[model samples]
Target chain A: MSSTQQTEVGYVVSSRDFLVYLDGLPTIKVNDMVESDTGLRGWVTSTFEDKIEVLMLDEGAIKPKQEFRRLTNRLGINVGDFLLGRAVNSLGVPIDGKGLLSRTKTNLNLELDREALGIESREFIANQFLTGITLIDTLIPLGRGQRELVLGDAHSGKTGFLIDIVVNQKNTGVICVLASIGKPAVVVRNLIDTLRLNKALDYNVIIATSSSEPPPLIFLTPKTAFTIAEYFQKKGKDVLLILDDLGSHAKIYREISLLSNKSPGRESYPGDMFYQHAHLLERAGNFLPEYGGGSITALPVIELSLSDFTTLIPTNLMSMTDGHLLFKAGLRSQGQTPAIDLSLSVSRVGRQTQDQMTNLLSTRVRQVLSAAADLETISRFSLELPPETQLILKRRELIMEILKQDPLTAIPKQIQAILLALPFTTFLQNKNRSFVEKYKVIISEAFLKHPQLIPITKSITKLKTDEELIKLLEAAGAVLAKLCP
Target chain B: MNEILSIILKDTYSLTSLKHRLRILQSYFLKTFFGEIETSVNMPLSPQDSNWLKSLPSSFYQKFNKDNIYNIFSGLEKIGTNTPILTMHLAFELNDTTLSQIGAFTRKTFDSPSLLLDIKVDPNLIAGTALSWKGVYRDYSLRAKLEQKRQELLEEFRKFLR
Candidate 1:
């Protein structure tokens, strides 16, 4: 092709607020590729009654009447197994400077047909997705293909919680996609480094669009990551996608919409803002067996201001998701590592996914904690309380101490069942605080030595009655007492 | 405003033809103020004008009264200054019939039909056409095809040498 054919020139008429208005190009469509004579690239954002507006892809000086040409190519990226252990931007360009990805590519705007998957194809979510965190695995049991929102105030261990989940999924054969939108470059770099150090990057794909990038690219990061997750899910692999925060994604979208001259509805967000998020999240679910019986369990994080849960984006996500794990700053101040508020956090569908033993253990633990919380509030006013209530409070404190887990140390599901069941047994009641703490360590060490016990605990799913479950728990307790004593 | 200009520019060839059509339209607007513009310029109530009149929506005719017609012309001039007319850059010139055929094709492909074809000769193209419209270029020339298949042709020559 001749040089003239390589470049077809259209004059820019005006420029302002990072948007350039071009005089020519009557055939230009919205989202069409555009480039300036000076090597600046952009996309046609809107076509007014006269001039067309182009959103610049790169920051540079674009002058009036400077010629630009349409590139005629839509934005897309390659997707495949090669993407695992790699870091990419919204366009799937390798931002990690690793190398080129595989040649098998797909469009970024590839539409997932939620209707085609349909309600008829969906199977009941019976299998539990283990996060390996004892507190979460025991209390808020996550079902496969469930979308659970993680809401927390700043510095309340939200990202730490997600990182722990990713770390726990290491050998579980779950492909993890962590999409970070509008985070600072340093934070993103640290996260990638953490994943690398933990060796979790092998089974993970990190999609990072930083805070400094254009709002449009930042807004597209999670959807691009979801598309990548869906690619793996189509192959029948279980995928755990953690969107670090949708609050920033929504803000970036609002910024883009306002810049494009759209009328803002509530809190300066576009009217379709909720639909935009809902549609993206609606792509996640358990598909029918004919469609590969795969699952994508989404843990979309939402940052709160001063522990406020009534914000527009948070409430919208809460309604869309199965349930939320509300992280509390107050709990963090009180030295809770995960900082999760037990009363506020819930898993609506996780109960169906739990086996008999886990359900029984979780119900007993919740009862002790709830009764302790009420008695403690009353004890704040009255120094003297019922002796039984005092014992429940002491037991609740020990349970809380047991749940205070460090980051990157995810307990296996079987070990978690054994450890949680130890507190509910009669042997621990009326025990001194120091003795109970020692007993906790001995129980952990006992399970660590006898890995064979995990299989026995797992096989207890065959137990037909509560009597059988009680007998098994008592037998396990007796074994632990013999080893620890 | 663009719609009116597009209809005027559709079959118009030269600057003289464009001016003539505008004048006829101006007179028609004035006559419609008194009663109705006689249907045609060359002959009153001609079949072409009657057909054109019948082809338009009733709402369009009702809205484009004498006063609004002036606004349409002013709006067209304003649009001409603010928005550049669609231009097609062609590799070579063709006969009027062929040019009209290409013009009609462009009208159907693009949103606007009031396009100006800027013709230039490039003998290097060898036989096929090359055109650029609305900042997008398409090269369908014979030279382009040969360049695309250069590797395959070179392989054939290597086989012959062996």
Candidate 2:
């Protein structure tokens, strides 16, 4: 196909253009040109007062019209899909042969150079974004508006985890922008295919900077993505910006540093590597009351070693973010889908959403897990222990049971609270034997029935009319009293 | 540490190709600056590159004669003059100087014939003026660019796969 010369005729700041480039085309009356290219020789779909938009006909169309018609839907430049395992170039072009992404108003005002909102104007992230995965939704919950760093070694599911978050957010009606930088051609192809299978390409916008591109373009990928997200956010939308991996960004900065003839720091990196990363991660926080209609949640992945976190980049980011979810290669080796090492993972803002379920689960599960973790440490030293120690062991075992979950399992909030409210902690307080023999089954059954008892659970937490609460109690009084009592 | 230094020394042996040699030499200086001195792994320079290194500044030969310089140029086989490479090195004088001052000194003052020396101030090197030219090599830059690239690569590679 022959190439067309595309040029910016004028810079439109808002509605006004400063200067214009007409390419010396013949001029005709605006109304007269509406009929053809001599006037404006393109198909017209619609017209407005200020301007008329038209699709340019291929070079060989016969008898150009004197008047132009605005054909909004008839434009040949359709948007395509780029899903998981797909590769795209810097200009939002599909390099992975996935076809163009499904179009959705491609001509949006996508602007860059956004001024970062001040910290005082930022809101604290408290809401839990439910990922139908039981382990994530119930246990190590991820909070909305939090800057979460997903780190792993090579091929350790860093990109996969980001995709899962985007796919799950579909239910929340959240817009997702997957920004890929310095990614390989083959991997991009795979990502697009995955998105197509999930039919998620329609809801997502992908911006990629391939390894073969210049440093400036690679650096612009994330910024351009944030600009797109800003568009969605301005419309009161929740947007997730996923920087597949930031290592490449750091590399770009290093190249720039070398070219600038700056002194290299440890590992031949620029002295300001940490600052560059911090600047991007800091942009992920939620804007406050003044800015309505949007929040951006960024998941920037960093690859690390089996147990090493002291490396410069990981350590710097660890302190910058609210916290990180460590996806262990060893766990993946054991066939874990998320490969999240719950023992070391945490969400600092997770406890902020204090409805019945979150409160019950976070407090009770944490108590059991913490106690069990300590007891396990002691158990290794001595075979024999106090009676309380045996009880602690039982409690620890129960905590592990709660932690046990299928990777993709999505647990409803009602079930999440019930599992937390179950007297697993009390069971640990009792004699280890009886608790193991009887209490375990009793608590498990209660937890399992939690969803069925949701009417009561909602009533218990609802700060509303008394009649609904009374009706809920009447329906599930026996179970409620039995557990809480 | 020794292995790394040796690798760097070996790489820098092709001194005639200024940039490559500069890159390798900078690697050595950075490690030394960071207290990570590695043993020199000098590769034998080809006769052509060796003759080019030999034709550098008289002071370069005087300070680091054949024996001392051999440790630095063992790996480089040859660097034909036809190539474009930025040969960057630093030279320490008794007085403080800037790049312009050194360049002025070499162009107007220093009596040299075969080696064309370009002097520049690089405070990253401790109390020295940098000598950057094809035939001659010196070091005294405040910092090294190669070290920065290596560090960036290590950091990025660690995160890229994750």
Fraction of native Cα contacts reproduced by each candidate: 0.50, 0.00
Enumerate residue pairs that collide in model 1. Answer: none
lDDT of 1 by residue, A93-198 (tens): 8888788876545523443222235677687888899998888888999999999999999989899989999988888899999999989988989988999999
What are the TM-scores, per candidate, against the unseen true structure?
0.76, 0.54
lDDT (10s digit) by residue, model 1, range B1-162? 766666656664323335555565566666767554454333455565445445656655565775577787677666544332344334566765776676667666765556544555667788787665555566777777778788899999999999
What interface RMSD does candidate 1 have? 3.9
What is the TM-score of chain A, computed separately for every candidate? 0.88, 0.68
DockQ of 2: 0.01
Model 1 spans with C-alpha error above 4 angstroms:
A1-55, A60-73, A103-116, A432-434, A448-459, A464-485, B1-79, B82-130, B133-162
Off by over 4 Å in 2: A1-88, A95-106, A138-140, A334-337, A381-387, A423-485, B1-162
DockQ of each: 0.24, 0.01
In model 2, what lDDT does residue A276 have? 72
Lowest summed lDDT across 10 adjacent residues in model 1 chain A is found at A107-116
